[model samples]
Target: MMMKTIKYASLFRSEAKKVHRSKRWKPIFNEPLPIEVTGSTQYQGLAPFDFVVALLQDGQSLPSYFYVHPLTLPRKTRANIARALNKSVNEVQCLELHFDGHNGDHLLVYSSDDDANILYLIAIGTHSDIFG
Candidate 1:
């Protein structure tokens, strides 16, 4: 009787390939929207920027509600952000993202109402750094 031995590495590789292929097989959003920084110096030249971009790209295949969380900012904070962005307060609905690899850092963003395909990065910082 002959016994066949399975190669674990090959099996793992094949499974990984399947997962990768599936990720690229279909996109939830027909197209990924463009992202723009709203001139907030808080997140400039930071790791969170790269993380957010990747999230936006990968999130195209999944509903944003699955990963992106809605934020309810204080009336004062909303006014502040609106003033900085030169946008009306009513137009600023913030979203929060606690990305990996950045301990305690939060990424804040909002999508443009006029252009749904455009995303605006509002801020990136810890709880105090953002709200305080």
Candidate 2:
């Protein structure tokens, strides 16, 4: 799969500024959380990237295009994530974006234990690729 690191801060700031100027609304988060895309092939396209941009622009509203919920993983998977993040299983609670019945691309993310505002983008792929 293709992999690349994205510095989302600049992107988010520009987008947020546009939203603020257009809508005269402040962003929900005081600061945009750091975003890291660990792995993905489809993410090379603009659809997912634009979706994320819109999500940020909306400022924390639960839109129909995505769902924010806890991720349930196997014991081994949980342990691996915990080890990698240097966090306990309980502290490793994850949230994901479920795009409306389109490409089945799952965006896995988790907040940093040290800083709740820091978000880590773990993976983006099909169900099998991400959880299988």
Q: Pick the candidate with the highest TM-score.
A: 2
Tell me how candidate 2 scores on lDDT.
0.44
The digit string of per-residue lDDT tens for model 1 on 73-102 reads: 788877865664557889777776654323
Poorest 10 consecutive residues by lDDT, candidate 2: 24-33
| Residue 5 lDDT (model 2) | 27
Tens-digit lDDT track for model 2 on 5-29?
2323232344444534542222221
Question: Can you tell me which runs of candidate 2 are displaced by over 4 Å?
Answer: 1-47, 50-62, 101-116
